[model samples]
Target: MQIHRGLLQQASDKGLISAQQVQPLWDFLRECEREQAHERPGFRATHILYYLGGMIAIGAMSLFMNLGWERFGGWGLFAIALAYGVLGLALTEYLLSRRQLRIPAGITACLVVVLTPLLVYGLQLGLGWWADKGHLSYRDYHTRVDWRWLLMELATLASGAVLLWRYRLPFLVMPVAVTLWYMSMDLTPFVFQDQDQSWALRKLVSLWFGLLIVLLAFWVDVRSSRRDEQRDYAFWLYLFGVMAFWCGLSLQQSDSELSKFFYLCINLALIAVGAMLSRRVFAVFGGLGTAFYLGHLAHEVFRDSLLFPLVLTLIGLGLVGLGIVWQRHEARISARLRGWLPEAVRELVERRG
Candidate 1:
């Protein structure tokens, strides 16, 4: 689906178009691709550096948060967060006012979303709502699974919504998805009555929450397709959705061989779903589950048997063969499948792709 400039030039040389027309046509096509969710943020060196810097900054604030940040006390933390958030918003406004910098603008808007939890944490400390022992650090927000983390997560989602309202930046949803994923785990205590909640119950909550997230992502994907928006509002949703679903599903206990086989089959179905939807997240999770299941079989069921390796090898070769066949007739196969789908479903797929 990628159009190389070389191919375009080759076509021009072959008299498909005059030499003067190629550059304009390439520019037009590139613009169209840029507007789609799957294609923007092209891999130029500058663009790569842009995302790398953005990710490092985001990680410093969220993932690798320093515990010393809590030492600033509630008011001091609030002041810092307020300063950073305001600065980020101001920069976002400036970037958006110009036509050439949507990516930077979106990243700046996302910083507002990232600062939500810090602001909420400050408020909690100032109001004496959080533990005063200073045992909870910003790092614990991600590492420790506790109900005390709910306030920050809630505030994050709210801020994400507000940012999306003001900016309509799809990258804002990444924080929303992260907060929701945390909520799925943190809400476990409230969902169950026992002080010592069972892992099974937790897994069930995760599985259901993941399924819900996936459904929401699919809805957003469809909506974005309908709207012709290229920002990819569903990317975070799909990423976290599969993480939750796959983890939950993998953690389940299957006592019988038939049940284990069923699990493997479901993973295979997930791989197929990935192809059908053209979503890599599905394939990544599905492939991981399949490999884990195979490993389980190798260690637990086929420990002394050599036959299993032979079977696995044959299965691998079969998959390679299948790939070859798919590559050779992908267009025909896609068209045939399209013929079988209902009108609405086909339209959605067309819009999404």
Candidate 2:
């Protein structure tokens, strides 16, 4: 309130706004306060439900594993309980909608929190079963595949995809699902037997899914820009994740000269894309790429004298400095363009610019 008052006073003093403007601004602030108040209960309730739900699910699973069928029902009971919980949530949402009451944010939060752990547990059980059999190495199969593990992975991925699609948060789920699918293939020993085929499949899947995410993100950016809501930082983060996925795939094959070249080129491309999107994301992508480049250079120079490391350090610093200078140049150009016109004119210019 104090900050807002100060701002209003300054604006009034500068003749940028009239004293009458203060009342409207205050009303806006009050509306915002009301919305926050309305959201608070839902937020708190959702978090509490999340914790309680997770505990119940875990406890039930543990009991079933310990005393199957007699004292505890078994894994089937856990699945049934989860399904019931989901159905209950749906029913509650329907009731609330019919009553014209606001749908609580906590409900969504609770569902996400509860489901996350259950999904992980299912993944572990499936992986464990596979490992116990001859299909995978390691008794627990943390990094190896089992049939049960594949089923869990598929279920989790499908559920997440459905949730994302339902919520219209495709950017959030696309990278995650892509990553899970990639990791599943990596852990599956059957794929490694035919290394080239496996590698090609992974690359193809990643590229195909990555392009989808990229196109979706671009569409979002366009729509948000049109709606004058282009400040969404999540969109930029999603783009970075997409770029990271491609870069990660390249790194996995770094033993090959072609892969090493691809990694460097892709990192550069990511840096360019980030620079175009937003400064914060650009800096993040640049920092990551720089780190990888330095790591690779250091490895190559490890056997050489101190001169090699020093030279690489100098080159890396130069690249970072160059990026900073380029960013400053772009900022100056943007500022000049924006400042050259009045408010209405600026909006018109922005549309074209």
Candidate 3:
């Protein structure tokens, strides 16, 4: 439930609120939404720069780590990361306590979380136990999936959990979700107990791991107190969850038409689930999957057939017509559907919302 500028206009048009009151009311509500104690910030110049700078710093130090970093050796790497982390934490505390710049504070905290894996990796490197699988380069850490990453991933998840618990900051979920995704790939070898694992098995791991994250996201969504304007803590979880699940589902090769149709049906079900949960990510993924399935049929099954495209165009126009009808009768339709649900189920929905 969000109150956009149009809603204010609607109230003025209906005489529910005087025209004189609208501007001041809108200004106050906008401020409330911006400064809501537990809510995330909206897009603004300061926030944009904060995130951009943070991301650039994260990318430089982590994702784009060069072999030159190894020149420092394990102890030197550990020292540099420790210095950066301590400085980041100090700045975060200062911002929170003195400047009250919570957005920057969150970014600074996230920087420390991002640095944790590198710090832990350095520690592993110093120890003799580091796998150094295939003598892989640091860049391979991101590109290649290997069991050697387990220690760093575990440390990252642990540290992220602690920081999230301490600060109640939703930004921490980014690192946690990323580490979980990494673990989903890196753990495949250990799970299979062999090096000759297939791509199908890897995708299968990702699919279930993604489902687990989605379930966790839903649970968090239901329990979050900052539900206004869809500024949810579950946003990153949903984004990555859909990515993993959709990729895995798309990778499967099915020769049977019935199996392909079943996949289409599953995607349609995802769209319905999106509507029920009021989460747009589900709808986005579901719609894309449905479009892909249709394109596959048009090309692979009905190659050189003009009839299918013409039918698809008609179906597109029909869907637009359905949208208009839906907009006009949405209230009545929703009320009727709600009435049909059992009392317990309706109550559950209400409570969850």
Q: Candidate 3 — what's its lDDT? A: 0.81
Looking at model 3, residue 239 earns an lDDT score of 82
Q: Can you tell me which runs of candidate 3 are displaced by over 4 Å?
A: 1-27, 33-43, 131-134, 226-231, 336-353
Error of 1 at 300 (Å): 3.0
Which regions of candidate 2 deviate over 4 angstroms? 1-8, 23-75, 82-84, 87-247, 254-262, 279-286, 302-328, 331-353
Q: For model 1, which pairs clash?
A: none
Candidate 2 deviates by what RMSD?
Answer: 8.3
Per-residue lDDT of candidate 2, residues 235-303 (tens digit): 533554476466545446445656665666776776765554543454565567657765776677355
- The TM-score of predicted model 1 comes to 0.86
Highest lDDT: which candidate?
A: 1
Worst 10 residues of 3 by lDDT: 223-232
For model 3 the local lDDT of residue 281 reads 85
What's the TM-score of each model vs. the native?
A: 0.86, 0.53, 0.86
- Relative to the true structure, candidate 3 reaches a TM of 0.86
State the lDDT of candidate 1 residue by residue for 1-353, as single tens digits: 67888889999999988899889999998887666533366677867886788888878878888878878888778888888899989989998886547777888888888888888888778877776645777778888777778888888888899889888777788889989999988889866764476799989888899999999998888777667656788888999998998898889997899988888898899898787777889998999989988998999999999899999999999989999999999889888898898776688766655
